[model samples]
Target chain A: MAEEECLTELELAIQVLVFNFYKYVPRRSLVRNKISKSSLRKMLQTEFPHMLTDTGNRKAADKLIQNLDANHDGRISFDEYWTLIGGITSPIANLIRQQEQQNSD
Target chain B: MAEEECLTELELAIQVLVFNFYKYVPRRSLVRNKISKSSLRKMLQTEFPHMLTDTGNRKAADKLIQNLDANHDGRISFDEYWTLIGGITSPIANLIRQQEQQNSD
Candidate 1:
């Protein structure tokens, strides 16, 4: 019943990540599917405020965006966006595992 | 207040993906951090039932595992695990975007 009416938790989470990328992609851009560096900064600040606080600082955000822009094209493609999310998750994932271990002990 | 008390939505989503990998890793393996093909199949069946129904077919699941095992090690490392999640999300993302556009129209 619930399975038929709604997506699984993992599916919903994946959608959130994907939808966030499209949210900032400019509709009128020639490359409408990708997000520009400036738009990425704004998206990070708004959607991931707690995860990416440095987005408030233009230089810091630019540096971060540059790392995610693998093609050096000044735009974040879906693959680049996925990479950024992976980068953010890796360290936090370790921290979470540590916490879980502590609590289980 | 909420930020201090709990992880942001994106962070929680990331943790779910990470923890799912750890859940299937065998505790007594020489390589505890990575998941074997068998364990990965079990995980896909249990944690991603809707998304990975083909896991019930042993051959299909093994084929999927082979593709995700990037280093030919027969084990799924964190990077490999991330790649699998990315692969699953990409097509669903396009579908979701189409649905959203239709709703807005």
Candidate 2:
């Protein structure tokens, strides 16, 4: 069976998240699965243009990365990347939900 | 400006994830933002047909939910749901990466 044939929306979303992560990782980087801090900053600027408004703020981005980088490693692991995305997503989700409720009322 | 007009791919992906959660929630559930275990199970079976082969196994689904329900609240909150998605996505990401590497070699 072609796995992609029956993939659902959630699954596709997961793939998009993963593929985006790989897009930020340097091909020649010794650490294959991790994204460096600078790459992460650029990723936020590019991939999260609307959701993360402070991507241009170096200090804010660095502090956000530090919060996500659980091990205090300057780079972001896949888990850390997931956390970052979730952090950004949660508030947006709430805002969207509130807007939806307001519109329905 | 239409916020939807310029949302990047990553932001869209995040919305997909959040909207999928609401898809399974009952309209009149006492809890506004939490997903019941049964709803979560159905979501896994329907949305992750390929990724979660054990969706047919009730015990396994329950156990998975139990692990994700950090507060033992008997329901999956959005944070727990995000964690669950991350858990499933990580291995699949690694597998896809390996496949890509193999194809390029």
Candidate 3:
């Protein structure tokens, strides 16, 4: 059986979210386990195409990086990256649920 | 076109994660937008089958709730829920990447 066949929905979802982080960090930078601002901007554009359409823009992406680069290291660590994802997902989650309710009504 | 078709991989993954939280919260408690300890325990056992096998046990799941109930509300808010998901995913992410490297070698 395929790996996904054995996984639950949430398990697979977590895997997708986690693996997406690695897609941006280069192999050489695996030791640091962080993505640069440019890589993050690219990730926002490609991976988060719909959810973060505004931040997918170059200037807005830069602003996001500045706000989320908690340690001022000029790079985004896994925790910081998770924080960014959570921050973005929170409001969108509310909106999505509201739309669902409206659709069902 | 279907809604899922329009979403990027990351967007769908986020939706799965976010909506899972609501599955545990009853409609009556919708205003609070939080889930109780028992609900969280059920969520962990059902949704996070692979990622949190140990916590699938009732005792371990309760321990997890205690730790993550940041406001001591005996309930888990969306932020707390996200934190728990992130905390669990972070270490598993490292392990998964390492196993991938080994498999590719």
Number of the candidate with higher TM-score, 1 or 3: 3
- Tell me the TM-score of candidate 3's A chain: 0.79
Docking class of 2: medium
Residue B42 local lDDT, model 2: 80
- Least lDDT summed over 10 consecutive residues: which range in candidate 2 chain B? B53-62
Candidate 2 recovers a fraction of native contacts equal to 0.61
Best by DockQ: 2
The alpha-carbon deviation from the true structure for residue B66 of candidate 2, after best TM-score superposition, in angstroms, is: 2.8
Q: Write the per-residue lDDT of candidate 1 for residues B1-105, one digit (tens) a residue.
A: 125445566656665687677777665542446788777766666666654452233444456577776567888777677867776666555555566666656
lDDT, candidate 1, equals 0.63
iRMSD, per candidate, in listed order: 5.0, 3.7, 3.8
Query: What DockQ class does candidate 3 belong to?
Result: medium
Best by lDDT: 3
TM-score of 1: 0.73
- Tell me how far the alpha carbon of residue B59 in candidate 3 is from the true structure, in angstroms, after superposition: 9.2
Clashing pairs in 2: none
- Candidate 1: regions farther than 4 A off: A1-6, A29-31, A52-64, A100-105, B1-5, B28-31, B52-64, B101-105
lDDT of model 3 at position B83 = 81
Cα error, residue A24 of model 3, in Å, equals 0.9
